[model samples]
Target: MAAAQGVRGCLLRGPLRARLGRGCSSGAPVRQQQQQALVAAPAPAQELPSTRRKGFLTEHAAPFSAFLTDNFGRQHNYLRISLTEKCNLRCQYCMPEEGVQLTPKSELLTTQEIITLARLFVKEGVDKIRLTGGEPLIRPDVVDIVAQLYKLEGLQTIAVTTNGINLARLLPRLKEAGLDAINISLDTLVPAKFEFIVRRKGFHKVMEGINKAVELGYNPVKVNCVVMRGLNEDELLDFVALTKNQPLDVRFIEYMPFDGNKWNFKKMVSYKEMLDTVRQRWPDLEKLPCEASSTAKAYKVPDFQGQISFITSMSEHFCGSCNRLRITADGNLKVCLFGNSEVSLRDHLRSGASEDKLVQIIGEAVGRKKKQHAGMFNISQMKNRPMILIGG
Candidate 1:
């Protein structure tokens, strides 16, 4: 989980050009100033009155909105929209090696439908939207989608969670289109292992994408690594070493079960295990403050320019302050990532539901959200969509 987890920051140019400062450097300690501008934007902070989810949006959350707030008073401000389910690579963990039954193109949300839902969410008090996919860069009009979302008055940030295959050539266009943050999935630092994991020959391309993102001034470009035992776990330090000079937020994600990919407890690398692995190398690893809604437990090594974090979705869950809502590529609104229940926004839109009617449907779905998802073991056993379909 990266954008699939949550996103932070805003664009320095394009639609947000008037609001952000201009300057690019590869030497900044962290987010530097572009993010500061986003933080100072006119949108209200995401503060929730609830004291349950510790360190979450207390004073920093936006004003409560009936449509966005759940029964627990967790004000949801982040929305992740899956651009498409089609992926160029066949990652072993993302989809079954035999592959999944792809949805017909006609069933997927059209560009306009995505934009319409985006505008609706912005009006409903959702400030951050992350574009996800089997690989979002595969879509030809993704840049245009970001452009349209950026133009929304109250929308504060636009991010993409990509496999980084086509990112090298498209990042500039995406930035010009008002794209703010990016999360690239790279589970292995080794080229051969990359091919083995993704079942594709695009390691060089992914590496190129990472370098290009940094070169183009997307500070703290998030690198998502799904840590699996007996696989790429040995390269944890190699991934962490990436943050020594670059402004990359290297996030280690715990592998969770879905409909396929054969997820099991043995493959999971817990948060504590990952933290201990990194701390063994850098005894000075320091814990960084994180938002209550944040799924990743952020940390940074002493004097390191970038930081390292862990998404403890398995070993430990952060559902208490959960503020994220996901829309599948086909436009089904999933309130919880692990929850199988969904309401079809695409179906409603296609059925000619009014804006107010759609809002009511979305609010009803949000209202039914549980205080938390099932435990890790139960989640693995329960039926859920594959990570690829869920847009993680």
Candidate 2:
């Protein structure tokens, strides 16, 4: 009642499709000019032309509808942008309490660059974009970015994933800028535990943000909780209770390993363990069919007003249906969340690579997407930036 809320892609290759319009010469200046033009003028929304070549995805194809498709036949319409690597809180699982080193402000992608790349993806068939960050709300220009992205022709959804600290202040402007949904990360129900996990004294602020989000009619406002052994695992039931009255989606994620988190297998609270715990408390809990491309396995408590989902990225891999891509704050594209490979769109953009070249680079990278990530057994060998740097 008192303590709630809070805490916390790829490339491909290809020839320039005709409908994509206005191919540019290969060079940094020419590409920058073309990117500038795109930012200046977003194409009007319309059906994309059919692309039926044996190696390409057909227009409007359900799963592989995007202009870029991987070897596994996954269409990627969801794009996650990391606005910055600088965060306010030092979550135990995300980064060091002392803070990790960050890229210089000059090197991070500019709002214009983000818009340019976002337009390219939307043109290529991305319909959904999520703004993420060390703390997206911390970036003063985030609302403007969201407003610009909403004007893109084919983009149907704009969302943000935040720690909910600044959401109270930013939600109205973001909502006005065409934001569609929000996912707030609040790992524990206890203020002391929240302070312990996040290494900050912002629990009340986060709760206020959550309450504001609900008040503002952010339908299906999601609360993301990362459950770990010997830590917040005891709060699983407490989180589920959140959905009983409010139209929230309380997602419990398995504790995952990344660089500098001191991760170990013993710390993971498996999805099965979580589901069982919920069932024991609510024998009538119902499983809900989830979107094929969604990472979570969804459920609802009988007569509950909201839902619960489990992002079993570690214990249960959903790679076959994974449809999301990530662009780091500095402009590298990550096709797979757990993968180490990144194609630098920022470098290419600044170097003056043509839009067609950028498309080709993206396609080639997506082509190399693995069928699945190396699981728990090889978890130690997987190299990745800390979760904060990688974006939530």
Candidate 3:
């Protein structure tokens, strides 16, 4: 994640976007002066994570002088910024039946405010940033935001996780704005199933957008499928077949508990179960090499064009090597996805806190990070935001 901002001309990014494919290239000029950015930001701020080892990720576990680094000697170089909490789809697994209460517009970060925080994190040690939300594309200024983030000198990869409801139309503009990686959420292929899962009518639009992403040369377009026990477990083979002919990375995520997701142990699917199920069909699935900080366990078929992986968040937590940080749409810094504790960076910033003060706030919150999140059973009982509100 410490890799710097030189991944242009179809260059592959760090562990954040591990799918195999050539990424889009862009060289647009930056206009940082136009925005109300942090004029008093740390001077001589690093363009990359470590000035000692520039333009490359610090592969070893050695500690660096990054503010994002916690006490456990983990350096967080990947930042997930929630663009908004408003999603176009209401997937049964992501949201509760009653739905999440939306954060007020006045409390949310403006485009300029988001840019400020992004700049701050990059200046600290963040090299890769993934824009997430209920649906980031729904934001009218998403393309502009992408363009601005691309302009950051030392930031390496710019990625987004969307439902693909509006990707087909804005993909060209987004690609031109320097988006290096993308993960589209598609839990079901059947149109009726899609509608049932999301409680919406954009199944065709989502499929069209996926095809468009593949057509537009986003190599190894990642398709995120949240696997549930009775709902979509039977479709695992169908998802694996997708990788046979295309550079698609179908990641089967384990169903997890959120505030309203009605998570139960019975609904959860373990990584071993999914792998065993696949091995039954092929009997020759190959494990792929990945970085230590990677959350997904990647694998592929013998001669398939694509690969598959599993996010073992429930059965097997990857907190020991976690190098990621999350910022809610409302500007709260969440050190862990399963942790409900948060520090309002928005509050500090709005109160006219200086750059040094902001660093102290961020460091304090990061310092309070637990060695690992609570167990699945305990986490289900804890109160936390729904997945949609927290940014998928």
Candidate 4:
């Protein structure tokens, strides 16, 4: 019986030895042989907790034996996590109506869950995290979530994109929570026109929020404007005027299709048109070098207090340089803003998946990412999911 046991062990060692070649040897010291055997064997597959895997597809199955997907070959390092699906205002381009299918409060990720996921993402080489939402500030505990995310090891910067309705109330807390910067969505400077576009009379509130954000030392507070033809397009110069005395970085975004908005082809604002308009006003506008993951082609005017950026999503798509992966309010991982498909992380997390398993799932999801988004403002093949449901 002992001879038979020895034979079985020898058979196992034979295959491992062949695989390792000269790197492993059975004739080595007993301690060294044992070490090689341990290295040859894969880590034991432990089942994820039942509670954690509850919502996952493989709940009844044994824990996944192989977790890592393709190595970080397709390195998309930016992540955008939507905190909520409820916004205060209904911008004509963002949301046409007030009542949309908001994700139930219970379905949203808890602050703890968000922090855990952020840590996991950072560990997997994600360097930047941006908090977005229907309005990120609308989420009551956004500050706490941001604070928790700050504790992550590998994250380099954290930003929030908000509607600015609640910025005044949340700015201090957000800064305290280690928020690096903010992007406030402001389409028009005229109060009545702003009310017309956003369908809200709280323009002053948003402006106040921007002012308060500046006061709290948030540098480069960006003002995002969706330049739509014949709508608030006439307010182009007025929007530019915002940069005169303030440190605001005003960005003009070409309207894209997603929501049930009145997105007509003719109404689309091209990057060329926006550049021409800006140059006609300020010919001294010069191009500025931007960070690797920045979607916008940033520019600065000579002796100006602030800068301007053009996001040519409609005219000159930046999908090639796109490094963002969006996590929806309910935990669906989206690889592209234009794609309809999603990888359900909520299901996996609810299932008792281990951190390593979750990382593999994410890597798999990202591996299948499309090479580019749908062509410039091509809405025919667009997904029915609204932008609010997708993080900005």
Q: Any idea how many clashes model 3 has?
A: 1
Give per-residue CA lDDT, model 4, range 177-257, as digits (tens): 777768889988888888888888889999999899778766667889999898877877777777877787899999887
Instruction: Give the higher-TM-score candidate: 1 or 4.
Output: 1
Q: Which prediction has the highest lDDT against the true structure?
A: 1
Please name the candidate that would achieve the greatest TM-score relative to the true structure: 1
Query: Residue 337 CA error for candidate 1 (Å)?
Result: 0.4
Clashing pairs in 1: 45-60, 45-61, 45-62, 46-60, 46-61, 46-62, 47-60, 47-61, 55-292, 56-292
Per-model TM-score, in order, reads 0.86, 0.85, 0.85, 0.80
Query: Which of 2 and 3 is ahead in lDDT?
Result: 3
Q: On residues 267-319, what C-alpha lDDT tens digit does candidate 3 reach at each position? A: 88899999999999989999997656678899999999889989999999988
- The candidate 1 region of ten consecutive residues with least summed lDDT is 4-13
Off by over 4 Å in 4: 1-74
Clashes of each: 10, 18, 1, 10
Could you give me the TM-score of model 1 versus the true structure? Answer: 0.86
Candidates sorted by lDDT, descending order? 1, 3, 2, 4
